[model samples]
Target: TAKASAPEGEDRGLSIVEVAKARMRDSVVENRGQPQTTRVTNDEEEDDAEDEDSGQDHGPLNEAELSRMAAMLSASALVVASAGGRRLRKLHVDLNRILDGKGNSGVFLQYVLSRLHGIERKSNTRLNPEADLSVLEPYEEALNLALIVAEWHDIVPQLQEQQDPYVLVSYLFNLAAEIGHANRVLRVKDMVSNVAEARWFLFWAAKRVLEQGLELLGLQSVEHM
Candidate 1:
């Protein structure tokens, strides 16, 4: 298959989809029953972090790095159907942007799952559905955040009927943004009994929604970054 897709004289070795599938296999072992510090392990990770801390050069990723970028892109296309979209008349693949965690990229999507995994580890317990949702203050930011998680089911049949995974992709990115903002106000650990329990449950639900969404997209849905 890689041979069929490769341009003339370019021995790319592996297709993007193959590479992503390989990583999905790797993720099962990598995320087995634990929370972790999931940072990207590629060549650029160290430089990217250092560049963020100091104002240093963020050089371009080489062809080898671009293949890694393709893995994320291919997998994400199966979900959202569009980074630029799965079907395009003409598209330019930007290796830098796809690998960027802050942007609306697959890495950012994984980061959300990683944070939810951290919350679960911190709570050190499973979801208690009986947790008092009514206790959530009307003005609490998490109130809105939970509402988004609640929409997960509503969006599913649409994706199936329309045959477009991008809808779920949109939902997930939005969900991640809301949860990231709300976590500042909704402390999961070291809080009152009911509050901690309720927030933990909320996050647990969010984490599942994220994981399921990614799984539907045929991605690994990492426990860490």
Candidate 2:
């Protein structure tokens, strides 16, 4: 079901959720490519015995607790998304680079989310979507993020057509990167009165979009690194 072929004039295909579930189990999943919804299995998607490739050593996976709940969902999603149509011979990769805040990986995005969480916590001011957003200036980064969030309405059909999560993953990564740039210019928690509230609303709005996208990818954003 990984690579679905639709009929002419049709956009049917296996969904990213189906791909994730199938890939995780290394098993067959329902294919959405056909009108009847047939079952298809791609053996290539199944993981083989674990072994580090000679050229790349992932080193030891961290002793940090591992579970589906704590499974670095954001990072994993990014990795999967980055893979696109290709399959990695091994799932292992350098965690250090993936988790680096200076990199454009999912971990870096999570770090930004943690920062937003800290700001909200320290400010002790609740951010509401309904907050006065008029005070927010048209910062390029913020506006860019707004445009991305607005595209959420268009994402479902694209996902349905492409049946690939790289689209979603790419969006999340870009949004996170933009928020990082916006944070450099906007100080939300540090300001007082309407400025602070307006800024928090902006951050909160971005946070909302990020969380929604992550949820669609079967991933999450954390409060702390």
Output the lDDT of residue 120, model 1: 66
Clashing pairs in 2: none
Which one wins on lDDT? 1
Give candidate 1's TM-score: 0.64
Q: Could you give candidate 1's per-residue lDDT for residues 94-180 as a string of tens digits? A: 433443445676767776776676666554555778998776775467788888988887899887787755577778889888878
Under the 3 Å rule for N, CA and C atoms, how many clashes does model 2 have?
0
RMSD of each: 9.5, 16.0
Q: Write the residue-wise lDDT of candidate 2 on 122-194 in tens digits.
A: 5556766566666665677667766776786787689778876767767777777777777777776547777
Deviation (Å) of 173 in candidate 1: 0.9
Would you list the clashing residue pairs of candidate 1? 38-225, 81-86, 82-85
In every candidate, how many clashes are there?
3, 0
